[model samples]
Target chain A: GGIITQTPKFLIGQEGQKLTLKCQQNFNHDTMYWYRQDSGKGLRLIYYSITENDLQKGDLSEGYDASREKKSSFSLTVTSAQKNEMAVFLCASSIGLANSDYTFGSGTRLLVI
Target chain B: LAKTTQPPSMEAYEGQEVNVSCSHTNIATSEYIYWYRQVPHQGPQFIIQGYKDYVVNEVASLFISADRKLSTLSLPWVSLRDAAVYYCIVTDRTGGLSGKLTFGEGTQVTVIS
Candidate 1:
């Protein structure tokens, strides 16, 4: 009975502007992840954190940065928004590698105009 | 990271059993097969996972082959609300402590009434 909360479900940003997305999970899980999904596409890894203050780059790590400030919260920042870019950013968390049952947040829809 | 291959799309009718198959011929011994479903405008949701043999949960069932190269996810009963893109993935043991799951283009299941 835990919840992953993603702030600002819909985000609109101008080209070249920096945007930040936040994710908070009350599951007390040790690992957190960020993924990006385009329309009609599968999910792509962006960044992941194993524990607090740990950061690891994923396949789609370019142009984005992630932070695991605390065990309950992880945040993602877009270095520079791309014009006409639209995608959904998802956040997920799990206990550890041995147990891969992850809980994911609804997502933050990003639109760069 | 083990590569996975699954059908791009599938069709099923309401009240019918829907099974989606995935092949991971290069799966390692420690890797596990996982099934996830993504409804439109939502994050991917975990269905079931298994290492070898069969595993079932309240939502779905996962059957892995003895060779561990192929697996199938079965939805007991399909409905209009069950229509979504289903993803099959294998656990990534490349990064230490980073439990990354690579998602490929999943099977889009269209449910008919």
Candidate 2:
């Protein structure tokens, strides 16, 4: 079994600051996803990539940018941090787009002051 | 993507069985029901998925009726570690390369000692 690793378990940034979260997967999956989770809310998809160098936006992708640098790595950047924003960013990967299961990383908790 | 609804929260005692139900009245034929769990400060973890009938895995069991309007996730014996937010998502298998997953509010299950 392979694992998905996310760097920087916790992040504290100032308002309007830029922060980046990195994810690496060893499953060699073709699809990678980035999601944000707020307190008392479910995960919301921000961006996803079907293949390397491909990007697709989701409902809440306005403030985030994603990059699929390689088959094994996907990164998300918070364009500008908002004050009083606290959320957990999660990275997931799936083998294929059709009815396949996804494996998720532990997550990176971000607190914007 | 079909919209899903689930209970806001639930409480169960240890060693008891917990069943969380999700409703998707407008689910499409090409869509599938997926269940995931998220512990505090962690990313969501895939539990199970099914189109119809019953599907069971080592971690959880997903039961879908013939009508496919609803699905249930059954936890055999509840434990403290099982306390978390459970989300039900529906995704269209035929959707283009980026198969976006929509997450519902999710049901928070608290296991009492």
Candidate number achieving the greatest lDDT relative to the actual structure: 1
Report clashes for each candidate as comma-separated counts: 0, 0
Clashing pairs in 1: none
> Which residue pairs in model 2 clash with each other?
none
Local error of candidate 1 at B89, Å?
A: 0.7
**How many Å off is the CA of A18 in candidate 1?**
0.8
**Over 4 Å off, model 2:** none
TM-score of decoy 2: 0.94
Query: How far off is residue B104 in model 1, in Å?
Result: 0.8
TM-score per candidate: 0.94, 0.94
lDDT at position A99, candidate 2: 45
Residue B35 CA displacement from its true place in model 2, Å: 0.9
